[model samples]
Target: MTTIVPPKERECERCGRTDTWNDDTGTWAVVERDGDRLSGDPFCLHEWDINGAYNPLEEGA
Candidate 1:
């Protein structure tokens, strides 16, 4: 069961939008006009919310 805790929100470095925690990929990624994908950066710390939209990050964006 996914724990519903008050996730800490953060702004993405690239997009500068608020993003919560992602459980599928286990990371924090914000929604962008492009798509959804792991930034390959360290952002996920388990203190995240799944309310944000999910998309795969494009090859180059």
Candidate 2:
């Protein structure tokens, strides 16, 4: 049996509320505000692990 890595339940930087992705849309629940800052966005986990986007929390976890 193959094990899938579950998406991390992360707290939004802006709202501080926890959210996750809706596998169907493949998008984050919250919108990213910072232009300069990268990672930890709504779907940062997916981006970092699956899509290869800017993910700052990669090292800490």
TM-scores for candidates 1 onward, in order: 0.29, 0.31
Which digits, one per residue and each the tens of the lDDT, describe model 2 over residues 2-39?
A: 97565644454453544455566655554345543334
Candidate 1 stretches greater than 4 Å from native: 1-8, 11-16, 33-61
Report clashes for each candidate as comma-separated counts: 7, 0
Top TM-score prediction, candidate number: 2
lDDT against the true structure, each candidate: 0.47, 0.45
In candidate 2, which residue pairs clash? none
Ten residues in a row with the worst lDDT in model 2? 43-52
